[model samples]
Target chain A: MSILEATRLVKRFGPVTAVNDVSLTVGEGEVVALLGPNGAGKSTTLHMVLGLITPDSGSIVLFGQELARHRVEVLSRINFAASYVDLPGALRVHEVLDAFARMYAVRRPRERVAELVELFELGPLAKRKVMTLSSGQRTRVQLAKALLNRPRLLVLDEPTANLDPDAGDRIRGLLSALARQDGSAMLITSHNMREVERMCDRICFMSHGLIVASGSAKELAGHYGAEDLEEVFLKVARG
Target chain B: MTAATPPSAPQALTLPPLSLAARRMRIMGVVRRDFAALRRSPMRMFEVLFWPTVELLLWGFVTLFLQTQRVPFVVTFLLGAVLLWQVLQKASNEISIAFLEDIWSRNLLNVQVCPLSSVEYLLGLVLFSLGKVAFAVAVMAGLAFALYGFGVTGLGVGLVPFVGLLLVLGWSLGLVGIAAVLRFGENAQVIAWSLVFVVQPLAGIFYPISVLPAPLRTVAWFLPASHVFEGMRTVMAGGAVPWDRMAWAAALNAVYLAATLALFAGALRYARRHGRLSRFGD
Candidate 1:
């Protein structure tokens, strides 16, 4: 497992410094949860790491190569999924997956799509346009697309943001299995405390565009002398 | 013991970097995805089939009343509309509007976070829309000939080439419209609409350019559509198509299209520089 490091990263939007001298490291086979209150610069950090936004200062390095210099090389193995981002509405579920699979250059897309269909239970709705699908179904499809290339590093803004409890549970289980078997590392953002407790190996607590605390879920919880991550989240978020 | 906990934990997880081939494939992926969207879209059917038919009937009535002594502008427009589908501006605008819809839906970041770059995304969209416009034009042309007997007096000889020229010209202007939308965003709707509206009255789609009122006549002469329509009428009317006039029109459209492409390229640079390329919805 190599290191993914953001060194002294700074970002400013006009008069505002969104990310203030923030730095963190994510390693292979590890899941990091970026927990923060609204407007805490979590998404901004993820955006900078992906090269979607450039920092005014500092740099992000993946596998020992600077991200800006090796963007194409670094990004090909990267995939992201979120409840908010969706495939084109005009595409059928099957077509959506097929297109992404082909885009990712999966050796045999039909086979890969079939595997996704089974994994996500998307077969029955394969013929339907994506816009017609419920949010949960769309989330599942997005996840299927994200996993199409067997990505190395995955970033999920809110993979299960709008799912029913049962569905969210299923997806969490699937993500757990994927992490255990494929050893894919992830950086996820969520407001769900229980999900963080169960899913993250390391939790980063962010406030005002800086990472104030990062450690194992239990460590942060115990370090703050809190009963659970939810209480720890409150203390950090209130700041 | 109830549970065995490991004391040592590997610090973090990582993935190997991607190769050149892998990177290219990811970009090509966006093109394929958009193509799939095109196939699934039903709006095109309405645009090519229903909209043209409706236009033919509705405008047919007006042309009949206005040009009782004349043949009818609807017939002329019918023929023109077949080719107008290939207008570079129209195809370009379609892709632009669709791009906005994606952003509004917040799905654009999903693709961007993957391997697809902004330029690659635009390329896929423009190419797909161009192909679609071509297909629709072909379809409408075939239907016009079958239903209305629009032979164009053996204009078929140079017809394909003429249509080809028009599409190339259209592609350049269409791309400019796309640039407008990407830059000005919602405010650019007026510019996009002008591409369609300006062509209608000035291009001589229905009536002869000579028939346009005195003040509007000068404006008509400045438009590429008038030249295209004049060329079409000359070929179909069995005239030599005034080769010199045709050349001038072609030259002018070429220059216009080139300028439009430049604008789009500039808009792209602006997006990249401003860090707005990756921005989703407003």
Candidate 2:
């Protein structure tokens, strides 16, 4: 079943069209990657999907309901995280997680927070204030917060951007396992081609506010006449 | 560190929609997050306690000096004005500062994208601000009695409506400040911190509206706070409750509240359309 269906989403900032005629969908348990160079309207598209930005013209259906009409009901079933956004810095790790767990109306908030604390290896850092944590540590905490609700669809923007290689690899592995074992759908944007290749079931390449190409990693590589996803990205981004 | 095993599958996706009780809990979540931050920051606590105490002391001494000049009932007038003005200041300042904290922490987007509606988020801020105002008022009232021997009870039952009107006016101004910040981004942050002061002269916090020049007095006439302060002075002067003044303030507040709420909603729409909210922290 389609977890999200966004059709012909267009957004403009004055004379600049940030996202134009973009249609995208994520199915149950499927991990989709949105890839593009800077200013490719990737973030705009993601924000529209999250209902943070109102599209100039479009329709979004989530879980087979119109998103505009059922925002609170639809949003309660999803969550988002981004490297550029932050949890409150003055709050302790556990407090931030607990607060979000409550915001998401999670059942058994304490247990959910404790479960995430262990899952993210945040046990030792739980008492530390969010500002005191390293960038990579903050990334883990954000991911943990994003899962507090056990959202059916998760939207992530550069989810592993700040993590060290070892931590990043573990997170990718954990996210893949979540999709495979838990049947959770995800829509993510990342510039890391290898990470996208490893985790995403399909990749959509965008440029100039439009999705120009989309396919599985191997198919995209073949369609672009490139050796790998990275070369394919270079070809699309440079065009 | 080794990766921990992933958790088991989530609960059924077709779970029931959020009930009204769950929605209220989400609002409380915003409040809890703020209170947790307040607990961790000594400076924030000090801000709540220190400034009100200092303002009271400053005005208390001024009234003491006036007493030497044989100014009859000056103590009640000056101290009463100080405390009432603080109520207005704290009520408005708390709301704007709470909003600013979210922007400064780069957490507005995180909060906005949740299931929490704008009205719920705003209600949380107003609720949190009321708590802060109550605490600050209690501290100020205590100090006023201990150090100056001036009791707010002297204002009698009139104090209730007086404070209520000021609070509504303050909330209206705070919403205006939030709308300004939303429309203009961080560059307009000064509106949150300084907008209250812009209304101070018109509010006639320490003086009668009649003291203003003709043009300014006309402007002050439309301000609900002016009627509140005028009514406050009448009460201190041993007159009746001035129901007419309170009525005027109440009616004005209704209009201001409606207009400011609409302004804030419109500004939020503009911000979302322009994608300014996503960059507010930057």
Candidate 3:
């Protein structure tokens, strides 16, 4: 079964439709990338799926249950991270992690926090307040928070946007590994096509509140008669 | 180190959804996090203490001078009004500012996305404010006793119902501030600090409601705090507990509280509908 199925979803803010009939799916253990330029409604669609916003029309089903009917139940098994949303800066890193662990009610919260702390390489930084951390460090902390629940469905928005190349590559590797884990599916939105190629099993290119094209890297390249997904994206985006 | 094996198509974790007990724990977790932040920052804690302390000291001296002038009901009229007003202001401001703290720190989006429902989040703020009020009230009351020889304990157990109604009124005002912040964002932050006092003139706290001009007295009669303050005057004037007035205050507070909560819910729905929730900090 798909972990997330958003069907015929539409959201409008006054005259501008943020997401228009955007239907998509992320199957069990699959990693899908939603690629779009700014204002393509990628973030808006993600917000609707997160139950942070209500779509004007259509439905979202996560884990075989309708979101409208069972949002809190569905949300308990899902986690989201974005650079735009942040943990409280006054809090120490481990304190923030521990607090979320308790909120998510993870089994063996202390052990889970310890494991994530080690996995995120946050040992030395754990005691410091989140405000003291650099941007790259904050991204790692957000990623750790997203993983705190061992969520079955993980949604990330521009997860590695501001990191240095090494940190970005490390995050891509970590996410790739997590996506490969059993019982988990991921949906990521990013502007970086190379990162999409490295991490996603399928790509949905969005523009002006619509999914204009969708395919794997090789398929998209061959379809567009291009060198790679980037060129395919350039063709689809500009056209 | 061994090479990593690819994950098989295994069964999903299928952890049971959060029970009521788990949800309560989540609320406590939020409260604990907020309390811990307040604990670490002595300045923020002092910010909560500073206003009430200053208000009490300022009025304590006034009441001391009034006693020499032999003002009528000096204990109940001036000291009582100031102390109770402090409780109302402290409770309302504490809860309203707690909501803003999440917004200023850009943490509201994260908290909202979790399994925490809007009601649960509101309850957490209320719980956190309860702690703040309890601590502040104790400190203020102690200082009133030491400085002016008047304290809440002087009212005996009659204090319970009075404090309860005042808190409900405060929560009502606090929720209105929360609704404003959600709808109008940071530009509306001033509402959190000043909304309650906008009704102060009509509340008839220091003076009796009869002292107001006819039209203003009509407005004052609608305020729950007016009834509570009048009840305080009644108690000081050798009357009974003023159960009828207390009942009126509680009833008015009930309607106000319900309306405030409804407005809060509607404001949240508006924020989500317009995509303002994420941009609230901006």
lDDT tens readout by residue for model 1, B175-238: 6666776676647756755565556776676557899898898887766667767777766665
Report the number of the highest-DockQ candidate.
2
**Which has the better lDDT: candidate 1, or candidate 3?**
3
Q: lDDT-based ranking, best first?
A: 2, 3, 1
Clashing residue pairs for model 2: none
- For A118-189, candidate 3 gives per-residue lDDT tens digits of 888899998999889998899999999998877888999999997888899888888777767545789999
Better of 1 and 3 by TM-score: 3
Model 1 chain B weakest 10-residue run by lDDT: B1-10
DockQ of each: 0.32, 0.62, 0.51
What's the lDDT for all of these models?
0.70, 0.88, 0.83
Clashing pairs in 3: none
The alpha-carbon deviation from the true structure for residue A109 of candidate 1, after best TM-score superposition, in angstroms, is 1.3
Identify the superior model by lDDT, candidate 2 or candidate 3. Answer: 2
lDDT of residue B85 for candidate 2: 86
What is the TM-score (0 to 1) of chain A in model 3?
0.98
**Which interface RMSD values do the candidates have, in the order shown?**
7.1, 2.4, 3.4
Candidate 1, A1-239: lDDT as tens digits: 56578899887877777789998888886889999998788888887887777788898998688988887667766788866577788888888888777555565667778777778888888899988999989998998888777766788887889899989988888887777766778889999888888888999999998999999989998899899999999989886
Question: Residue B246 error for model 3, in Å?
Answer: 1.3
